[model samples]
Target: MKTRIVRVLVTDDHPIVLDGVTLALQNTPWLQVAGYARSGREAITAVERLKPDVVLLDLRLPDMLGPEVVQALRAQDSAVKIILFTAYPDHAALDAALAAGAHGAVVKDTERDDLVDAIRRVMAGERVLCINAAGSSGAALSRKLREHGLTRREYDILRRVAMGETNPEIAVALGLTRNTVKTYLQRTLEKLGARNRVEALSRASQLGIL
Candidate 1:
């Protein structure tokens, strides 16, 4: 039987990382670098256009964060496997991305062989989270998100607010009523112990909940 090639769209801002990853993927006979995207929007667009089998996404895109990109991509195509390819594996952002429905994560400096293995495993219906050196601190980050007690909707609202989206805009984007968006925002603020949106964002940032 012929080996099937997995098409992968890699999204990262740094040219050097992009080039290196692309080269690494190219070295594998069964993996194809379907396309490259430097920002979250471009990744979404490329996924829509190319319909790649897998997406290797950077956690910090110029436009959107890792979790946001994961949510957006999953919204568009539930079948496409997403892996958060980030340098900050110990950060709360990785936890958020996994919660947002990525297949898993692989640290940016992961071995090329292990990266390939991870992609293959994900394709084979396994979740792969590769945070080798993060140790117990990564577990602590996951705990922090849960301890905040922010529902997914509330977290979504908080992130939107951080992006400067008005309630009406958030409502439209989330497909919720304006009042519903306000309610979620209020819940988020209360959870963060803030009197207002700005303070909420500040506190969330300080707590690494953002």
Candidate 2:
């Protein structure tokens, strides 16, 4: 019998990381490194162009957040599974990643064997949520979000605002009125102790809120 080969695209900005990961995957007979990307935009483009079966994506990209990438890819209606490979290892970030439709996650320092296992597990039609040893759980992320007093609507507004969408544009995109977006954004800012949109996004990322 022959082993099934998994087509994988690995994305990371660091050359060393890319090289290391490529080397690691070379040891796995069933995994093929189809392509590589160095930025969020490149990764998105590669996904479309290369059409890999799975993506091992770094959570912190030079051009966009990992969850944002997940959301963007899904919005394009592609069914390719994505696994976040991040060093940040924040529980809240993982929660947001999972929420955005990521198929799995693994910390940057994950052992070669473990990462291979995670990829196989995800390909086998299971959700993988392997966190770093020091990472928090989904429950902790929910608690923090609740403690910050942000409603789901407010979170949505903040994400649009973070992407530099105007009130009218956000309204149109979210199917809400401009006033509603403005209201939710204001409340989101207040809840996050931010005085402006940029600060709100910065604080939200720091808190792993988005």
Counted clashes in each candidate structure: 0, 0
Model 1 weakest 10-residue run by lDDT: 133-142
lDDT of 2 by residue, 20-125 (tens): 8999899999999999998878888888888888999888777777678888776654678899998867656666667678998888888899999999999999
In lDDT terms, which candidate is top?
A: 1
TM-score of each: 0.75, 0.79
User: Which candidate achieves the best TM-score against the true structure?
Assistant: 2
What is the lDDT of every predicted structure here?
Answer: 0.84, 0.81
Query: Per-residue CA lDDT of candidate 1, range 1-210, in tens?
Result: 999999999999999998999888898999999999999899999999999999999887767666778888998899999998888766666666776799978899899999999999999999988877445434666577688887767877877776557999999989999999988888888888899987897787667666
Measured by TM-score, how close is model 1 to the native structure? 0.75
Which segments of candidate 1 are over 4 A away from where they belong? Answer: 133-138, 142-207
Evaluated at residue 172, the lDDT of candidate 2 is 96
